[model samples]
Target: MSLIILASLVFLLMPIFLLLYIRSYNRHKKNHFLEKLNMQQKFESEMLQTRVEVQDQTMQSIATELHDNVGQLLSLTTLTLNSVNLNDAEKAKKKIDNSLSLVNKSIKELRELAKLLHGEQLVENGIGHAIHQEINWLNKTGAYELKINNQLLDVQVTSPDKDLIILRLLQEIINNIIKHAQAKHIQIDSYLEKNALHLRVRDNGVGFDPNEIKVKKSGMGLNSIYKRIEMINGKLALNSAPGEGTSISIEIPYP
Candidate 1:
């Protein structure tokens, strides 16, 4: 009779133990999910901050270009009008013609700048060709050694906004290299990885700490790269060390 009672008690306690185990497991899972969610939120917040900073800097750069070049040209045209005597019609006409020519040149340069700001044809062509053209410009300048490895022969990722983000991001990167890194050999590669487009920009230059993105002034550019990627729901990875080299890779999801 005692054995029967003990067996019954054990059967009752088994379900209780199972219930306790399930409750503990649920708690653990909830904590894990919460932790993951918090991390993602933090990452998003940081990315937002970076985007704001980068966009502001880009706008400032454009504003400076306009004031320094276009504004000055306009001011000179005004001064020429004010200084020249009206009695000298032919000479004034000649001066006016010269001023008009200068204005035209300034307009042409401003158009190029506008093209850059607009990200002209990023969607019509794939990112690979777009990058090829940008590097071609850099090559023509003979400022940096720019090489591209074609890996996305038939891949097409098209979006005006994404294109602008990527092109501008690289522009900032190259600008940083020109002004700071003094990089010589720069190789860029673009390919498709899994369900996304991947790009890598490698430079043989004086690289610095990736952690320094927090304190370094040039960190803004790096942060821009990251935020741009994030804006497209992409992924970015940077590898660099002082006096070594830098390789930045970005992966954009297919939209």
Candidate 2:
């Protein structure tokens, strides 16, 4: 009787143990599925945020160019027109000619701005052209001497989101140089190698200690660059020293 009772309990407990094991497995699978879903959602949210920030920066660039470049050109044209002596044919012709030239320049600038306004389409086009367009706009300022070697111009590879992030990253770096570097020369090189995209930017600027920036957590822009690069599984190398120039190199996997 004792042996029969013991056997019966073992049989009953086996089914219970199996039920518990199945329940635990199902719970684990459900948890894993939820975690993956959450991670995907987070990625999408970050991507959207990055897009908004890029758009905001583009708009700011547009506003600045219009006010500083195109606006000045138009204003000068207006003043020349206002001073024209219509009664004197020769003088009037000269002033009118100058005004026409200015107007034409302004028209060209407006056309460039129109292209900038389509900044989002940049990804659709390709990173190389978009970068060239940006460099052209920066050159218009005539503030810095730029040496550029962009080898990716003819290469056809697409990574839309990464391209936008890369553009924003370059813009941030340029803005930092413009605002604080007090530099006179900028060098940019971009190319593809070993299935990786590389961008290198160097500036003869009043450099700072990268270690200090990291320790103090003071380089907000730098932090953003690192964060975005990490998001894209990319890497950044920064070389800088006080009284020496700064150089930044970014490496990212290709599409």
lDDT against the true structure, each candidate: 0.71, 0.88
Q: What tens digits encode model 1's per-residue C-alpha lDDT throughout 1-255?
A: 999999999999999999999999999999999999997787667545544544564466567668876788878877777766769998889778878887897797577556545334533576666576566556745667678886764665566456556666777777877777878899988777777877788898998888767355246367666656765788878888989988888888864
RMSD to native for every prediction? 5.9, 2.4
What is the lDDT, from 0 to 100, of the residue 123 in candidate 2? 67
Q: TM-score for all predictions?
A: 0.60, 0.90
Which structure among the candidates has the greatest lDDT? 2
Lowest summed-lDDT stretch of 10 residues in model 2? 212-221
Which sections of candidate 1 miss by over 4 Å? 1-6, 104-172, 183-194, 202-255
